[model samples]
Target chain A: MPLLDVDYMLGLVPILLRYLPLTLQMAAVGMALALVLACGLAVIRVLRIPGLNAATLLFISFFRGTPLLVQLFLFYYGLPQLLAFLTQINGITATIMGLTLHFSAYMAESIRAAIVGVDRSQTEAALSIGMTNGQLMRRIVLPQATRVAVPTLMNYFIDMIKATSLAFTLGVTELMGATQKEAAGSFLYFEAFITVAIFYWLIVELLAWVQRRLETRLNEAYRR
Target chain B: MIKVEGLIKRFGGQAVLDGIDLAIEQGEIVVIIGPSGTGKSTLLRCLNFLERPDAGRLTIGDLNVDVTRATRADILTARRRTAFVFQNYALFANKTALQNIAEGLIVVNRWPKERAHARAREILERIGLADKADAYPASLSGGQQQRVGIGRAMAAQAEVILFDEPTSSLDPEWVEEVLGLMKRLAAERQTMLVVTHEMSFARDVADRVIFMEGGRIVEQGPPDQLFRAPQDPRTRDFLRQVLATQVALDVPD
Candidate 1:
């Protein structure tokens, strides 16, 4: 038996690449939904809205405390049994749901810190001028908070993209799922995994580049 | 006119503002001076309902709030009539100088963008920051930022402008520039309440100076009377400590 098979690994790269778009789509949809949910949660967390606060706290605690895989399984296998409306949820939907719920909890805290990290003066300034809370947040607090939270949010997105690999365990044939099948069919486990690993490394590199460019634009005002 | 009756605020178990009562006449520059941790800043905040007083009533022009029964709408109404200039300037870091000035007008007053921007630019010119209208707060010096903060308050057409140690966060050179702006506003007879450490500002610009310590107005009167002949011993001690530091700074090594 050959110790290594360069041809098999080289061929496996394209097989993995074929499924990369689905992986990206899963991450993109999940991250977008997560951002919106996180912002809402973060605001509720910040304001400590009466009855809603306990729910947000429970969500954050549950998501943060459990492993992502367990959450993915719960969504895939557990949710449909409990809720009639959720009975039709498919594997891909479940994967996205898990990613969004799991990541929203993390992003919410970052966004909350950014929102609260804004100077007390800024809130005072906005309020003293007669702005309602909604106007103040939309016009003053959120804009600044976005700048402060963008870097951290970008890092979350990168983590999210990688986390989409766990989607394969739910039987959604994303990149890692594609690689698992190819390796099983050819008995070239190392070749399949190395190819997938390179794909991950490249995706992270690409995202890092994008994050740097965005950070620079956002930081222009902060520079003297 | 601004009137506050029995305004009380607390933090944890300690009372921060202990039944404050005061009145400010129109076109008066009232300076509140006190040691750190005293309720001077809290009192200023209470006037506009920034730090909600636990009890009592506040009236600023037409906006009135009975602390015992004030609704959110009442607070908004009061805030509409007043403006606060923070110790740190508190300019919108994401906005240009003009945008910072125009934000309240556009967002709160519902002024058209064009009209609000025009007014903002005019205020910037009056504040001698017309050339810096496009600059972000981070790029501007502390003095410029504070001036923009002033411009923001002025643009609101507030009945009373509250300054919370406007010069506290500035460098020595920047302090005079800000004080000069405050002096001009005072000369125009803007109804204002200022909290400051600048004895000279309180001396030259204030119509009335209030000295506070331990959550109470220890003494209040014309600056001449308050500064030259403070009735309270605490006032005397605070002034002595502050003046000594000024003298120390002024002397050559």
Candidate 2:
């Protein structure tokens, strides 16, 4: 018996590729939702907003301390036991929730670092010109912070794309889920896994290219 | 007109500005000269509530704010009435030169964008940086950036402009251009309170000069009397040291 199945691996590409949209959908929705949630958390952390800040700290610690797979399982299988309304949540919704909460805890710190990294003089200058704290953040501070944040946020996004593979255990037929189904019937696990891995590698490489272009564009004003 | 009475600021247990009282007339250029760490910059920062004095009262025009109990409205009103030019230029790094000048007008005054841009363009022309409108702070030379910083302050058309050692951070070659722009502003009778180590510029432009040491004003007089014949021994010693340094720099290594 041959140790490899090159033809099966080649054929497996098309079958797995069929689930690319679902995989991208999960990552895209999770990334978009997480960005908003993460920015809010980062602001709360930066400002140290009284009682809300303590809760955010606990939320970040809980999400970041646990394994992503376990978090996905908790949302999929665990939450429904406590909350009756959560019982109707499908696997896709649960996976998206897991990704959003998990990644937002990490992204919030990066965003906060970027915001703080902005020079103190920038704040003073904005105030000297009569900017309220709110105006300063929107007009002066956040624009500069975004420049410092884009590269790191793109890194999180690429990680989120790979993390979508965890959605499979929740019974969502994404890229990895489809591969598992194909491998179970054919019993060619090596070919099936390698094809999905190649797809992930290609997606990461493509995003890294986009990241480079984006960083260059965002940093145009800063180039000496 | 601006008046700061019994202004006191502390950091930790130490007072950086200890019971300082000062007054400046409209369009008067008051130059503050002091040894480093003498609270000269802190005094200017306090007027706009940037440093938030622990105790004092700041009266600028009709708005009187007790520094210790200043509300957000008082702080905002004080800031709106005055503008600051920093030693580090502090031009918004993400913005172009034109945007830096226009930002105050748009944000503070709530002027229409076209009107703000038009005014900013005129100021750019006045500063002779009209050609570099699209250049970011990083792309400009230090002198150009400082010029933009001044232009930003100028665009506000505030009641007074506070310059905190605006030339201290510049390369030696760039100092004169900034000072020259300041001189032109002075010539126009603009109200300016400057903290600077440039004695020559202070001597030439200041309507009144103040010498501060250990967070207190030791002496103040017209620039001619202060520089030529200081009344206080402390002021004399400080000037002698400063002039000696300038003389030493004049000679080759």
Candidate 3:
């Protein structure tokens, strides 16, 4: 193998950093959308609201069971051919939609597990205290469930940041897309790809560090 | 005041609460005692519609609680009148003790946050947990958590509070702390329907003692009358067995 090119890798840093904002925006937008969808799906499954619950379960199962790459292609490529409306959507929007759907399925399962993890007795206690179903979920159940979900949700976010790399396949000029262009022009695939890998690793590490800090803070009151 | 008539509950094929009838006067403290699995807890849960009775007529101070017959809104209104404390001290684990106590007041009563927090603090102090107000349920000992549970119930200011084996899960040494708080609450003339295994506390704190067996009320009377001289054979046998076990455990080798 060619001697590890430190100078070349160092030079690629500024180039990759230019696309960092785009990468962060995709992850942030995807996460916000996924959170909204996940909360709805989780509540449906947790409460088992008849037809809605069945639909949510199917949504979760279908998305989670299939590979995310296929889902991305289906949204970016397959859907536009099938429907004219989707053809009007841009690559960035399609990438975000794909990321949101894929992440929301995993997030729904995580959130449902967290919600179910709360003791049944707490719900009963809330009800006996005269809380309506809405009040119980809003004031009691979700507050507790969100605490339990923080770590898992952060894990999903970290996974989401890595998953954004696949958006390059849709021709969205995110960090990975920028890296591929830079590598193709410069003919330094190894150096360019390694720089992007390092960037992703650093962000994931930062998120993992924040996750640990959050977990400790949330659990601090309970610890002696 | 409450009236329960023809209360029946079944889990699958097993009858948990066979048709039972009882009347509780306003400001009365009624202690229901029976062997485990005799549906004592079930009966208390039924009062708040936590475990809806399969067949029954429940009237809490003139409001009917047979959910099947009552409108959804009406049932909710009736449930607000009665608060329940569980064996496990079901304080929301993620919430501070104060938040747990203030939640019902804020959500159900629409009390402002400041007023709710103030009232919650007062109740926590009354329950001897003022210093632990900001602590989470997981931070407190079992006894402290149960006290917080009592405080949560008191904060709701419901007309009646139901306790289902409140101290049964406490450490033996710490049981009295919870029972003591309960005794004080009973003395304050809080309308309490308590299901407990602590015969001593029942005898001391209850206005009336009820013995349940096979899901039916077999006997009831003043605590002194029931404990000193139970009329039914089942009650006598139960008291005898409970006392004999305590005695055997206490006696030296």
Number of the top-ranking candidate, with TM-score as the measure: 2
For candidate 1, what is the lDDT?
Answer: 0.90
Instruction: Tell me the alpha-carbon RMSD of every candidate.
Output: 4.0, 2.9, 3.0
TM-score of chain B of 2: 0.96
Q: Which stretches of candidate 2 lie over 4 Å from their true place?
A: A1-14, B247-253
TM-score of chain B of each: 0.95, 0.96, 0.94
Clash count of each predicted structure: 0, 0, 0
User: Which ranking of candidates, highest TM-score first?
Assistant: 2, 3, 1
* Higher-ranked by TM-score: 1 or 3: 3
Residue-level error in angstroms, candidate 1, position A125 = 2.2
- Look at candidate 3 and tell me the lDDT of residue A125: 83
Q: B188-223, model 2: which lDDT tens digit per residue? A: 999999999998888889999999999899999998
lDDT string for model 3 (B86-144, tens) is 99998887689999999888989999999999999899889988899888888899999
lDDT of each: 0.90, 0.93, 0.87
Candidate 1 residue-wise lDDT, B109-198, digit = tens: 898999999999899989999999889999999999999999999998888999998999999989989999999999999999999999
DockQ of each: 0.63, 0.83, 0.67
- Model 1 lDDT per residue over A1-224, tens place: 78889989887777777898999999999999999999999999999999999999999999999999999999888987888798888888998999999999999999999999988777878888889889889988898888899999999999999999998888889999999989899988887888899899899999999999998888876777
Model 1's CAPRI class is medium
Give TM-scores of chain A for all candidates: 0.94, 0.95, 0.94
Q: What is the lDDT of residue A160 in candidate 2?
A: 96
